[model samples]
Target: MGWLAAGEGYEIALVDGKVAARSTSGRSAGKQLKTLPKALRDHPEVERLRRFADWLDRHAASCVAQVDAWMVSALPVPSAVLGEVWADEAWQAALRDLVVVGAVGEGPDATGFLRDVSEDGELRVVNLDGETVRMSAETVTFPHPVLLPDLAELRDFAVELGVAQKVEQIYRPTWDKPSDPNQRSSATSEFAGGRYPSRFALAARAESLGYRVSGGYAVHRIRSGGRMVEARVWIGEPHREDDSVTGGLSWSSGGRHLPLDKVDAVSWSEGMRMAAALYAGRTGER
Candidate 1:
């Protein structure tokens, strides 16, 4: 952004997402100041720049959140939508380098890291073969890591290419369900018994990590295999000052508790992931 006259001899503009000032005269003429000048602190131009910077930060965060939701839900996004938003810097930052697959159709069905979206809604991607390919599919999906067939290989290749994604994808941790029916239980106690100073502390930690606090549990909802599943970890009562401990992790569908054996893979992994994250924040862990 170009500098705007702020006060008497200073001009202000956004530098690295912050309001910066420069003198238009004297020894410091045209030199970016290390700090905003006191006179320009309350200037209308400076205030407006600060407000704009704040909006940019919020817009970037919102973009990442939306992309994260799409990845978690494995929703199909239209190619036209991608092209429409690709011009926005914040949206491009969040969508670039994400792994995407063409929705089942006659168009290119291969999985690759998204690179570009043309004005005509064509997608350019770096395929597993280390080749750039164009996909003209009507829609594409940002598959969850749990559903990616070549997740491990993709991680290694991403490292080789020095891919730094704004949204967590290839490097996101995952868990697998036990295949043996004998080992299944309605809920797992692996992350249970984690102590917290107070119920509020545990619940606050859950909320800080983007989980919803409900009743006595921290819940993470996932849509998998066309079913809505909720993974919940017991975090004790709502009493703010009452000491609490974490409890077993479980999954439910349509208000009915599900056996670990019956929970779908994505649901099972997400539930365990939430339980483990909550446990990791407990007090005095050895």
Candidate 2:
């Protein structure tokens, strides 16, 4: 699902899991309000709109996660698959600007923005020279960074042509799935901000960095000592928003807490990195 901004006189509306503003009669409410009138803001329809907006946001994140998974796995996505997904506006928007190297009969050659997929399943690519090249490959893989042999050259090419990928391309992180799920690790880390300006800012930053938001904590997966554990960073408490002190970062594997020192070097650094980003956004003194 996706969201489209309303034309006029509305906040938001629900459409096939997507959101738009409700176009209704009366004065087209355009002016910004510090606060909304209770009657309108608290209306049942308006509440539904709020819920839809939240769903739309989650859906967008999910899309990013799915694409990231494909890239990480270096999965061979069939041309048909791309065509089907392109039918959805949201998916198309997410994939439009990604770089692809089509697996032609000879080998992977045409590399550029996946401009279009024709009806007969032809991959239309705009090469570095800005020439359109049609390619036919039974399977097209969104190569992992390690697999992109010409990554440096491609980066230089993109820069020369002012080609900016809508989805992250230059620096997409990838990791092998945990090999041993039963491995034990008693690692922990802590993140504290003196205070925060707003919970929204903290949450948005965490989500942007691909952390899962839940129970007022920003949770991310990290591999520590051969174990995959979740690192949870606190956003704030129910009543803590106003004063907004941060201090609840923790690590757990199989529901067991691990001490910060026990965490592996990579995992420990990742946890602190997330914490530092949130802390830097605090409104009060660090």
Candidate 3:
């Protein structure tokens, strides 16, 4: 739903499962998500994804006039010593570039830069005390060495675009037990399956650009007729922000009809609270 809201679509449901466990072959440091499915890779959605990437590139070009260049060597076949190194003029130059990139369309200032030589690779820093670490080409799958400020610029740009355009969220739902019947004494008796109700909603205030949350309302039961999925939501009282009520806090029974494929997740009050908390933490304050 989030992706669709961003004016993009996904062919496959993104599963948050570990595709691979421990492996002798040195690759990623931690477990990674499964690879993209063929359907997703070849879907029309790729075009939309490319457009998103294009936005990043546009932001990058606008934010920074020039980016730093670094030389890197792979591990094991190393010919140089592996250890920390002191700051240098090259580091200062890189740091300046980052500052310029970070402050695009804003003010300008030079932070600090430092360099660190390590066994993994030659770590370059453009800011003081290694505030901004550099990733070389060899370290990342992508050809470019991702810069903190550059990535931040892209994010900022995306938010700006999203807000200005009023993007719609893409909905994708996957249920654990799609065919399971709802339990007795449940609120959703109208439907054949007494299945639990759930919703994966991505909504935010008009002021915000990007969707601030991945929310859901755990359904008591959802009935599928034709293309619509009637979702029965157990409403909680709206959330309170200071004196104002941001969302209703009533536990009243209500229902919403949405596309069958658009359901992102089952919304439970507890789960929604957690998700809201996470969003608040990321943005710093509600």
Candidate 4:
């Protein structure tokens, strides 16, 4: 099949279980995807593509996580490691276009794009500024967006470099830490009373309120209390008929359950709003 374009200015295609986006126009069109119709989105083939896209995002995030750790822990990485992993296309793609700083003394933070490596494992960097610099450190860092002083300017720089991040990095909200020192979070929703004639209607109503349908759940993600949490309201278990009654919603962080009372303030309200929206759609045709 030919390329299926999703968001504006970009066409997404699956090649061997991997999703790749090619820019069709000069501008970024990430917002265009939010309008994808439910029917088209739920199509089997489309779902597969989205899964692949999500995988691509996770891969990029994994690379970033590793780099962030290397920076934070002051871990000493062998130069050979970079030379080795740099040859892997997946690793390279994840690392490409990210702002990388040397282990402090190696050099100032630079926008990484093109590079060359020595046979011995030393890496030479060519930044967005068209300047060539060498990092002599054993480790590198990919700092969080909130920690970057030149974040705004760097985003513009990324655009110039044709760095279209597959992950939600550019816009995903970040906090210095969770606002709640108690490390507690919970979510309560008024959507408990709503009933739906079908799962499609339930999902549609939630979508109207900006919740995303993931698998058998309608998911709402919120960043609060120093955590990125998700409230997943059940639409149905997989393989269930559209008429199935969904179970209660639940809150989680990093895949672990979050208590309803401990749910952060923002998460609590948004979760309730999503629940309320879905609840309103649940009707037995009465």
TM-score for each candidate, following the candidate numbering? 0.93, 0.52, 0.17, 0.41
Candidate 3: tens digits of C-alpha lDDT, residues 1-286: 2223111222322222111122122463233325643444545555555555566555544323222111111012121222211133222222222221111232222222223445444444443333455533232211111223244443454353332211111111112212333321231322112111111111233114222222333222212211222233222223422221123111222334433234423322222332233233232222
lDDT for position 245 in model 3 = 14
Among these predicted structures, which one has the highest TM-score?
1
lDDT of 4 by residue, 9-102 (tens): 4565665555445556656543334344443544555677877778777776687666544432334566667778886566666555545666
Per-model lDDT: 0.88, 0.62, 0.28, 0.59
User: Which tens-of-lDDT digit does each residue in 1-286 have in candidate 2?
Assistant: 3332433444554554533344344665543334444545556666767786687677776776677556544566787777777766656666765677666554444677677876556778767677778878767766555456666776777777676554666454422223343322211223475466667666777788778887678887764344677777878653344555556567777779876545554454456556666666677875
Please say which candidate is ahead in TM-score: 1 or 3.
1
Residues 181-272 of candidate 1 have per-residue lDDT tens digits of 65556347778988888999999999999999999999999987888999999998787686788998888999999876679887887888
For residue 18, model 3's alpha carbon misses the true position, in angstroms, by 19
In terms of lDDT, which candidate is strongest?
1
How should the candidates be ordered by TM-score, best one leading? 1, 2, 4, 3
RMSD of each: 1.9, 9.2, 23.3, 12.8
Which whole-number lDDT from 0 to 100 does residue 184 have in model 2?
26
Model 3 ranges off by over 4 Å? 1-33, 66-286
Question: How many clashes (backbone atoms < 3 Å, residues ≥3 apart in a chain or on different chains) does model 3 have?
Answer: 29
- Going through the candidates in order, what is the number of backbone clashes in each? 0, 4, 29, 11
lDDT rank order = 1, 2, 4, 3
